[model samples]
Target: MEAAWVNILMLILILALIWVWKKFNSLWLTPKRLEKILREQGLRGSPYRFKVGDTKETLKMQMQAMSKPMNLFSNDIGPRVSPYDHYIVNKHGKNSFIWNGQKPRVTLTDPELIKDVFNKIYDFGKPNMGPNIRSLIPGLAMHEGEKWSMHRKIINPAFNLEK
Candidate 1:
């Protein structure tokens, strides 16, 4: 009876340790490693802030931008619609990065770079947003591989100049 009790306790302790290690790796180690890689690649942006990342700053900027009224005649809506992005681009140049929670999003302002990325779609993977955001923005933009290619084929006709 004493030996059985000891074995059960040992198993439970091992399981608990495994769980804790997984949480630590997911929440801290992974993000820190990604951040270092991005910085080494010459990308600059806000440092990762635990699990929240840049959510607080992004929300504040968006709220502040939306609070002000826009000029009806002005064609510049980028600042109003995406204040956080505008602020980041201005502060960090054309090719910079921003943290979307644990994920680092790289901003490509150069037309050629954007074209190259789009051309080699399989080389890059899409960022994983929260469930709420995913629900709001679904379809071709979120798809990958065959699904993306199929969606693009189905929608390509609408953009043709001769159509």
Candidate 2:
């Protein structure tokens, strides 16, 4: 009975250790590594925080920006909807990035880079959405790899001027 209890405790301890390690990597180490990679690539923005990320700051800035009424003639709604993005662009230039939870969202404002990213679709994958959201709109947006290619090929003609 004593040996069985000891074995169970040992197994639990090992599992707990593994879980902690994974959490540490995901919450801290991975974000830092990604930040380093982006910085090296000449992208600049917010530093990687432990857990909360820029969510609070983003919300605050957005609220402050949105409170002000925009000119009716102005077509740019980017400032109202996403003030953090606008601020980052102004502060860090076009090729800046920002933290979206654990993920580092790099802003690609340059036309060349935007075109390149679009052209190489496989290289830039879509972000994972929640199951409820995914179910609500599960069309081509959720697809990847060959499925996305097939979907795009079929859907492209629907919007083409020549069609």
Candidate 3:
């Protein structure tokens, strides 16, 4: 009986390890695969740096430029979007690809493609916000469904009109 449980546990662990390996290795952190995709698309930028990629470089650059944030931009209106835009712009020359650690983003310079893509954006489905882990909050909400809704509604007033 004890040996049976041990065999089951070992099988579960093996399956879990395989799942994790496939998830992270094949899906997101494939340097060679991404390189091939970019090369095929004729995308120009720095080569990917394994898992860390551009995240380290971007963060380091962000800290260095944080002191003199004013000097990070070229045009007057460009800096208004976000602080990271300045970091991106400083590197990409207005139209270039940026590696955001996990993925490479290409800023399109061609006006025609931009307008066309914006017009025909319906093909893409809404993004998955991923998984929802159960919380330790003790209430009707902890139970399920309509109970959760009622609890959420009751809690909403407490948060909104707090004195």
* Tens-digit per-residue lDDT, 13-33, candidate 2: 999999999999999999999
Model 3 earns a TM-score of: 0.52
Off by over 4 Å in 3: 2-6, 26-32, 69-95, 124-163
Worst 10 residues of 1 by lDDT: 111-120
TM-score for each prediction? 0.77, 0.77, 0.52
**CA-lDDT, candidates in order:** 0.85, 0.86, 0.60
Model with the higher lDDT, candidate 1 or 2: 2
Tens digit of lDDT per residue, candidate 3, span 25-93?
854667657767876776566667766667777666566555554744466644444445565657655
Q: How close is candidate 1 to the true structure, as a TM-score?
A: 0.77
Ranking under TM-score, best-scoring first? Answer: 1, 2, 3
Pick by TM-score: 1 or 2, better one: 1
Whole-structure CA lDDT of model 2: 0.86
